[model samples]
Target chain A: MNAYWQCLRGIVLREWLRFVLQRTRFLSALVRPLLWLVVFAAGFRAALGISVIEPYDTYIPYEVYIIPGLACMILLFNGMQGSLAMVYDREMGSMRVLLTSPLPRTFLLCSKLLATALISLLQVYGFLAIAWVYGVQPPAMGLLLALPALLLVALMLSALGLLLSNGIRQLENFAGVMNFVIFPLFFLSSALYPLWKMRDASQWLYWLCAVNPFTHAVELVRFALYERLAGLALAICLGLTVLFTLLAVLTFNPQHAALRKPG
Target chain B: MNALTVQDLSFAYGPCQALCEVGFSLAPGRFAALLGPNGAGKSTLIALLTRLYHLQRGEIHVGGHSLRDAPRAALKQLGVVFQQSTLDLELSVEQNLRYHAALHGLSRRHTDLRVEAELARQGLSERRREKVRALNGGHRRRVEIARALLHEPRLLLLDEASVGLDPASRLGLNQHVRQLCREHDLSVLWTTHLLDEVHADDALMILHQGRLVASGQVDALVQEHDGDLGRLFAGLTRPTATGAPA
Candidate 1:
């Protein structure tokens, strides 16, 4: 167990170092969320009316409403970005160094997921600090409780990214998956607008948002930030994380020649 | 026990077979050469041995552990220097070595001492603080070799690690690797297409079209074909009067 922790610590430290060195990446991760919160939310503030939701006893501003979503957005993007790096590393042959360690491949992949999740957590916290500076802050205690929620969401998203990294052979295919999967997953979620707003737009879209695992991930963070436990959100996020992580492991198994072989 | 054994190794990428019934073995202090042309499955075989790709119909044992059921154990005794560089250019030499040591679960104090010893042994002691990007090709390859040995693995695999180096550097690196095998009693499987890279006394395996066309000591194998390894290699790898280059 000590050795395992040491390995995990090294992996996480390497990831943190990598995150710090890549200035453009860290800044861009922050920039995208700020755009959604400051620009998109500003534009849609008057357009979408807020109602009393379960966590909300009174009306909330559009900026406050999208804070969790922005945080989720950072995690979602960083998770995929981390997976993208994994695919690039595999192509470049660095991943072989990581995978060929004597440790179980599952544990190695888990370490990568955890490392990515921790970085995503950092970016989320950075986004939250910026959001606070912009005058939209969660309850101080709620912010503390939200750490676990952020971790859960980060795990789910990173697992999804890992699944994609194992599934896609080439980096070129990643763009298509991002456009087809990530964008739709984000827009269909209640990240930017409320489900009620989507309901008015179309019942089908509202249903899609409700079913989207990303929606649950964002809602999981949002509810936790209000010092509330979202049972449904927790269930879906945990379930998807386990399912995706298992799929990633299966895809990465050495015997899975079909998956590893170049197309 | 033999340090490494590969029996009837076969693997394919979809419809195209990359390795077909290839077999070889290396005793505990032997240096073996896997010579093949591009697309002759040398890389594929290395991949299989390193557990990057699994065998479809074959067996590979490192030390005594089978790659299939006991990969973790098998891999623990194996180290590889791949064709492409794997060093993190952002890291210093010591940092890179320490990171790999940690991955193998070495204690911090021991890892630090071992890293220093390895660096000194590899002649990189003075450059330990230099970032990987600051090092030249030969120095970088040395760093990789040093890192691979950090765990004191019994078997070492080198896949075209000397490519793109000056002739002097290439020969120097090869000599260093060969000396390491002799001094440390380490088994080595070095894959290269360069005919000159194979020593006359080294065991040689020729791979062509994903099959082992020949295998034996270099002198004997070449002696069978009129003491000409280059002609024999060319004959094995060249397209047979084809319409165009394969």
Candidate 2:
């Protein structure tokens, strides 16, 4: 309906306006991955082997090999940080304003999640543009094909962020999540190294990486950027995105949650 | 039908009861005030009325639409201004209003017109382009009031809206809201703990320890209970040494 469209447009516009005002967030997001790409990757090139995985026919250098993971890192950080802001919004009373809307709660939350995801795409593209200039270019057609994959990963991560934030009712409790959630999801996945390397390091570690949803997100982006489809990765990302979103919506109950904590 | 109706509403925070069998109604175009002490569950009632808290046991009807059975319709007929500022400080005054209008699903042209009309009505047309952070406490509250009126709901609820304002600003806000009620035929439920905020002719409900102890015309209730508001409020809300309500 036209109403839904207008609501979504408004939500996205608010996010875009906020993003513009806090341009430092964009720069902060870019700095971490760029350090990994331009500095860490350069230093570790001799240490890590570059192999031609499935969906790849030509040899890709270490710089190109890790591009998908770093792009997803931006999404990961943005998604978690976005949900953190939601918790802070609750304290500041903006979340109450959003909930008081005439629209269904599910619809409002979804619009917000999608809007955050869409705004994050700008940062992803910014990183990709820098990579393009740094000599990590994929095929032009492949670049076009990777757009939807990047968006899907962004949505999946954002949903996961929301779901995780449900258990964290207090703002002070969120710093622990950065260490307990972000570091595990980032380091245990195929972001820095492929799964085969993890398998070579340890079978149990390889299974851990294989099952992490972030691994599927990264693999899907990696394959899409090479004009190939990872059907299994596609299925896992889609399934997890739906699961995380449903769980997030179901658990986001501020009123029922108690304000007190036991000593 | 009354502009708003709440019947036998009860709620709890875990094992602690926040509201118990509370009930009230506001007639069309009447300005009603909800007065309660800090721990008297005013926030709980506001949360329930605004749907920030789900209904645990009671029924609320707004403009003839049931909040339980037809939430969207019920909510469409109501407007609210929370105690804390909900306007995005980084956004312009007009931008905040437009965001609220869009959330209510107004068309772009309709939103523009409504925004313009509300600014003029609040005498804030000159400050539309300024960021909310630039506005002083009173002007920011005016902007919030204008934003709440954008969709033209039949009932307006202000939950301790005059908190953190100068005494003069508080009086000005109260008078301005009364003028708005006259001009728009809008029913208002103003919740506060301040005794000076309630005029003699206003409809008054005094809540105490999770229960409403008195409700009626302010003058009549004051005459019936005690000679003065300070003594009457102290007698009603004071807890006994045994931790029981007076």
Candidate 3:
């Protein structure tokens, strides 16, 4: 309906305004990925030599190889941080305002996820732009091709974040998400090292990387950035985005959090 | 027809009962105060009314639409100002109001008109561009009230909306809402612990320990009990007293 479109536009506009106002958040989002690309990748390049991977047709520098992962890293952090904001919103009464809207709760939450995903794209591209300037350039067209892939990954991660936030009753519990979810999802995936390298380290660890959804998200972006298609990664990311979004919507009961404390 | 109705509404959290067999109604354009102490199930009732919590038992009808079966319709006619301020501090007053209007699915033209009207109504026209964080508590509350009325709902529920305001601001807020009720034919259900907020002519419902113990016109309840408002409220809500539930 017209109203639904207008509502989505409004939600997205609010997020865009907030994103513009929070200069530090934008800077920090860029800094984390840039750190990995500049400092960590530089240090790790000699320590880890990447062979010709499926997405890479030939030998590539460590920085180039890790570009997709680091790009996704921005999304991963932004996704979780956006959900953390949701927890804060719950405590601060803004979430209540959001939920009490006349639109269907499902639609409202989905709009939020999409808006946050769109904003995360801005950060991802911003990081990529800086990476391009840093001489870690993807093909010009490849960078454009990666937009849809980045969006899919962003939605998947944001949905996953929202799903996690539903179970997180308080902001204090978010540290656990950082340690348990973000760390494991990032470190255990192909984000830092190729799955074959993980196989060289340990078979079980390689399997964990192979099965990690973030691996698919990374591969999806990695392949797209090289102007290639990653069918399996695309399928997996799409499926998980849908599944996580559904689970988030189903479990997001504000009353559960509101009533968690005894009256 | 009554603008709002709750019949045998009850809720429980784990083994603790928060509300039990609560029933009440507000005629069109009337101002009703839901007077209750801190732990007297006021928030729980508001939560249920606003659909934040699923109804465990009983039925609520807003503007003739049932909450359980027709929540969207029911909610369309109901507006709420929660105990906590819900405005985004980083957003300008106009932006906050526009967001709310958008959530209610107002068209752009309608939103612009409503936003203009509400800003004027709340005496916030000059402060429209100001971020909510810069506004004092009273002005923020006014913004919230204006936002709530943007959709022109038949029933406006204020759950402890006057909390943290100075006495003068509190009285002014109450009077403003009362004026809205008179001018717009708006039905209001205001929840608060402050007895002074309730006037003699207003409909009064006393909720104590998860039950509606007393409800009627304030003057009639006071005259029948042969005491002032404070003594009557204390006598009914006192823990040891056996106040009959209405």
Tell me the whole-model lDDT of each prediction, alpha carbons only.
0.86, 0.89, 0.91
Candidates by TM-score, descending order: 3, 2, 1
lDDT of candidate model 3 versus the reference? 0.91
Q: Which stretches of candidate 3 lie over 4 Å from their true place?
A: A257-263, B241-246
Chain B TM-score against the true chain B, each candidate: 0.96, 0.98, 0.97
Q: Rank the candidates by lDDT, best first.
A: 3, 2, 1
Q: By TM-score, how accurate is candidate 2?
A: 0.97
Ranking by DockQ: 3, 2, 1
- lDDT (0-100) at residue A55 of candidate 3? 73
Candidate 2 C-alpha lDDT tens digits along A1-263: 88788889999999999999998999999999999999999988988877877766866678888899999999999999988878877767788778888899899989999999999999999999999999998888888888999899999989988887788878899998899988989889998998899999999999988899999999999899989998999999999999999999999886733222210
The residue ranges of model 1 lying beyond 4 angstroms of the native Cα positions read A253-263, B235-238, B241-246
Q: Which CAPRI quality tier does the interface of model 1 achieve?
A: medium
Q: Residue A115, candidate 1: how far off, in angstroms?
A: 0.7
The TM-score of predicted model 1 comes to 0.94
lDDT of 3 by residue, A1-263 (tens): 98898889889999998999899999999999888898999999999888887777889889998999999999999999989988988888888777777789999999999999999999999999899899988899999999999999999999999999999888899999999999999999989888888898999999989999999999999999989999999999999999999999999896964444422
lDDT of 3 by residue, B1-246 (tens): 899999999999878888989999999999999998788999999999998888999999999999999988898898899888989999999999999988888999999999999999999999999999999999999999999999899999999999999999999999999999999999999999999999999999999889999999999999988769998898888885453332
Q: After superposition, how far is residue B188 of candidate 3 from its true place, in Å?
A: 0.9
Model 2: CAPRI class: medium
**lDDT, candidate 2, B1-246, per-residue tens:** 999998999988789888889998999999999998887888888888888888999899999999999999998998999888999999999999999998998899999999999999999999999999999999999999999999999999998999999999999999999999988999999999999998888998888878888889888888977667777788888987965568
In model 1, state the lDDT of residue A225: 93
| lDDT tens readout by residue for model 1, B1-246 | 999998988888778877778887888999999988887888788888888786689899999999998998898899889888988888888888887887887778878888988998899999999899999999999999999999899999999999999999999999999999999999889999898889999988888878888889999988888779998788767775641223
Clashes of each: 0, 0, 0
